[model samples]
Target: MTKDQKDNLFLLVKSLTKSEKRQFKLYVGRLGVNQDSKFLSVFNVLDKMKVYSESLILKSTDVKKQQLANVKAHLYKQILISLKLNPSHQNIRSQIREQLDFASILYHKGLYKQSLKILDKAKELAIVNEEKNLAFEIVELEKIIEAQYITRSISNRADYLTVQAKELSELNVITSKLSNLSLQLYSIILKTGYVKNEEESKAVTKYFNDRLPKLELSKLGFREKLWLYKAHLWYSFLMQDFLNCYKYALKWVDLFYDNPKMINLNPVFFLKGNNYLLEALYFIKNKPKFINKLDEFYTVVNQSDFPKGENIEALVFLYGNFHKINQYFIDGSFEEGLLLIPQIETELIQFNNKIDAHHKMIFYYKFASLHFGAGNNQECINYLDKIISNKSLSMREDLLCFSRVLNLVAHYEAGLDYHLETLLRSTYKFLIKMNDLHEVQKEMIKFIRGLQDIYPQDIKKEFRKLLEVLKQYEDHPFERRAFLYLDIISWLESKIENKPVGQIVKNKYLEFYA
Candidate 1:
């Protein structure tokens, strides 16, 4: 028995929208001969099922045990064919590919004139849409046809095709190199997060410079510029340069706006660019600009012209809700933010397969912070435990380290002091092993550990002293990232002032703006 989630055919059936299901059924019945088709019956049985059971399938449908696999396979393929034919799936890329296929078929049939004509139009569309790779293929095909049938303007036609091919080939190579560098940097982030020390920074810098191709930015097309921005953005992020991250992220999103057509064509990149931009703003604590950028993202993605699909929908949910919750954190409205967690959790489950484990864990960390801000320390610990115990979360070592650190604070606040010594020791060991023992983390650990011996009357004085010490690092290049995670200054202020952390944060926010 296969689990419902593991069975691709069953999952595909579950993933279909009602309209898609209707279309699949209509498509099966189109031949009239397939009205009683075994594959159609198999599809119907799987569609009605919440879980996939091979036994149940055999019992419910005419598909025999031996033939069940084959029938299910056919049904899956047919449904995909139906989806491909759907108008919603027919984008410009698909249309161009279809034309290319038609042109190839016409060429094979010796219809050279019609084939060349179709190839010409398709090549133009491909170039306009930044599908240069496909454009190169069309050019290659034109060259093949032109070689066989000499045109009246053979010299000019050959020269034109040769130039187009060479230009497209060169541009494609640049795009490939930039894309490769961008993807490698992204992998580094997912594998180990930002560079932990000077050695790692040097290594990343070397890797980046080695792979980056030399080019004039002005001569690059939209796709090349997009990848270029991406490479630089990832490098800045890994180097912990928030200002550079903001600069490059701005360029990435602006490229789409400058070419509005690409925004609709490449909606995911557009959303991601804005998300990164907002993230940079969040790191710098520029709440006003963060809010504006977040608003702009929502407005653009909500437009009816934006592309719609399952993948893009998941990204919209992930990025949109993340920034929405982040706004609450910025404003220190933890109580209000708490209202969003339940709904967000529900959606998280709905998007479970689509959203990656790293992001899900990050969401848990945010929830923990929200609970901690509202003085619900035990609740905070609960969410933090989810992150700490997730052995499967291999990416974002920094997030794991911070979760444990925050867990220590939450445990102390909730009076769960019995495990404090053990947590402190384990967290310190983990940070050191990960080579992420920054000054903020070091100070935080020392202050928390020393709390055990402080006289009750002197605790407030200790908190004040620690706050003063950490204030110096609030703007430090590397150490400030710790504050980005835990906001220890505000936590200490809450203790000294005998107030809720949320109130302290809100006051600090007001002071910054003032």
Candidate 2:
């Protein structure tokens, strides 16, 4: 097996719950030969291991080096089959696919009547569940079966099936177009954090406008509406239009709420929609709305009918805690947020494989920001190092760029100025290479580099001057995104006032916004 496939097998094994592991063993042991099966033996060795090791497998099992790859491949397929049999994994979509498979088998046996009957029932279920793609397939299968026989209802049946096919094909086309637009927008954000200038903004706006389907909103189904809101959300995010982000994100979450069953069918979207809504609220500084919406999110998640399983469990923990920490940043109550770090860190380690590298790095950045706001400069630096030293470059460039910028700030605040110049030089060079050298970054770097020459009494004077320059761009078109990564304006005000940074932020919220 290739290295990625090998790691996938190991990760899959690690992801299984205790019951799932036991179920797999029972599934394999159903046959007497499986008790002493080579794959089972390999699985046993892997299950006992904390990490994958081919040498350890050879040392522990009777399986030879030459047969290891095949054995691992067999074990991987068998485990998935076992998982497929689990009741928790058998969702409505799987049920539809299963029925389609059965219908196909019956059709091959020339059981035309039986196949049509099954297809009819499956088609009804698919239509009722808004599974347009599957419904179209079921209709096509019905058409084929009908063509094989002469029936009393043949004339009526043929017309009905033809119309069904055309209608479903159209609905699927709309969904496909919307989903495609949403995905392309998401891909652009991952590659380039946001539009940096009018040219990029026009490109994104044109792309969105050109691809967006022009259907009456009232005529669209739940799925179509959901994707429409998501596309707009991403567009607003890229445009740095927080209020519009909030608007679409609210509509996204409301779509799920309005279609209560979709919440169960598509929990990932539900979780993400709420997260984005909260993120937008944070950007727009709407504390009251953010608090209310977050409460609503938890209420929905904590319900008895909410889906359960390892994957859902991991997602719930990740999104729930991410916004939980972000709330502190929103309010500048960093120390209170720090109280949850120990438990969150423990869970993060437990969920290390379940969560991806991007999310883990994001978590570290939030932790570092919390510590920085709480006046624990050294603790903040420790967390920042975790992000700075990471090797992966696939994360958003803006995220990576801000990690270094925040690191420079943390080091300077910690009285580690001896290291700041080298760090500042590296950060500037890194941003230039990333094509992310905005005015805010340049000004911040310029001020930090010139700090060594300024007299002690003149430091606050320079802070005031720097604050004036940054404030101008606090609402500037392309420059404001810098504040999103780090609230430089707030930090500067805190320094000028000689107060705790959190105090500065808390005062801002309570005074004007709150």
Candidate 3:
């Protein structure tokens, strides 16, 4: 190629937008570049176009764009030409090439179901072609997509169940639905290999040992296993099985140490950081000796550099969770919790402008929660409003929790009667679906307790009615705590009525003493 022609080609490749790049490829083909030298020039341009297109798709704001379809067509045409000239290109495996083109086309067409079907067929072809390594790659991609879908589904369902449980509580129906939902969720994670129990862990170890001879370790990526390990640790923590939490956490750390390259990938780094933070929190109550280790983990995370992406912003929120928990152990003070607000706010803005609607909702919820905890009620209300108004993001348990807390705070402090009435109605609706009488009573007591400080006479009358109903469900252990709170409220009520404060105090002491 002449220098001028080469420069022109470079500029064309560089300047073309994603759609225009596809047009450029078609234009190049029409130029009759059949000679070896001419074809070489066209191939270089196509290669550069591929790189540019891939980067655009990866970084694009609109993931649903049709840019991939054009690229897929271009790749398919090139592959067809290469196959006609020779069975395969020097660098491309014909079998892999064909499957990828098909998959890419299907993906771009917004037919993920069809795309996954093509990928499964391609996986079978890879196996038949004795391309086990390629098959593994296809498997990993399939799992990544499947796992994300499953996680989203699980989150949505959990949110629904939480809201239902709350609604049931208001109807005064005993419901253990949330606990049952949690158990079912744990079962799903266990069965999917996303989480492992002790039996499952042992079975997995034995299977790997037996299959190592046949398995290509290079192709059997470690990141998937690390994810499972981290999930197992979380499962253990949720179950309050501390030993298992410690064991699985150590296994997760070992995986990172054994393959430091895991950190080079964004997903792996996020998972690693998450697992480390979970471990640190697990040790807070039982293994206080590990506080220094937890600090070390935080230090490593703060120093580790992250490339700009949605996942990096996710890491920021995960770090926020870490810092929030660390405050609990470090000094048992709210200062550490306050310190995380600015960090979370900064990261929320970073994500708000970049990530998908789902992620934006997640960050908004976090920001709202942190603001509420920090006594920034108006800021919390603003963030909560954003989440509620986003139709694309479904309401979840976390959102309900924030809404309930915000409403209660607004009613008590700001005397926002409208918000208070809304909250009362919402909480009553939520409680109707709950079977756990204890939790229901606790929530009710909290509501009344808040009211006691502001409207003692009205709250006292309401509490008397609630306590009478709760006495019918006195089997709940938390009922005792509710009574204690009620006693405190009664004392405040008498004091508000101008009875001597000492008389109220003595009555509370006599009640406890008796």
Candidate 1 regions with alpha-carbon error over 4 angstroms: 2-4, 153-155
Alpha-carbon RMSD, each predicted model: 1.9, 1.8, 18.1
Candidate 1 vs candidate 2, TM-score winner:
2
Which regions of candidate 2 are displaced past 4 Å? 1-6
Query: Candidate 1's residue-wise lDDT over 317-366, tens digit each?
Result: 99988888898888688999999999999999899878888899989999
lDDT by residue (tens digit), candidate 2, 94-163: 9999999999999999987888888889999888788899999999988888888755455598888899
**What lDDT would each prediction earn against the true structure?**
0.90, 0.89, 0.47
Q: TM-scores across all candidates?
A: 0.95, 0.97, 0.45
Cα deviation of 363, candidate 3, in Å: 4.6
Among the numbered candidates, top lDDT falls to 1
Please give, for residues 236-343, the per-residue lDDT of candidate 3 as tens digits: 544445567677677766666576545543334545545554544434333344554555555655664533333554655555455454443232232345566576
Worst window of 10 by summed lDDT in candidate 2: 1-10
What does candidate 3 score on TM? 0.45
Overlapping backbone residue pairs in candidate 2 total: 0
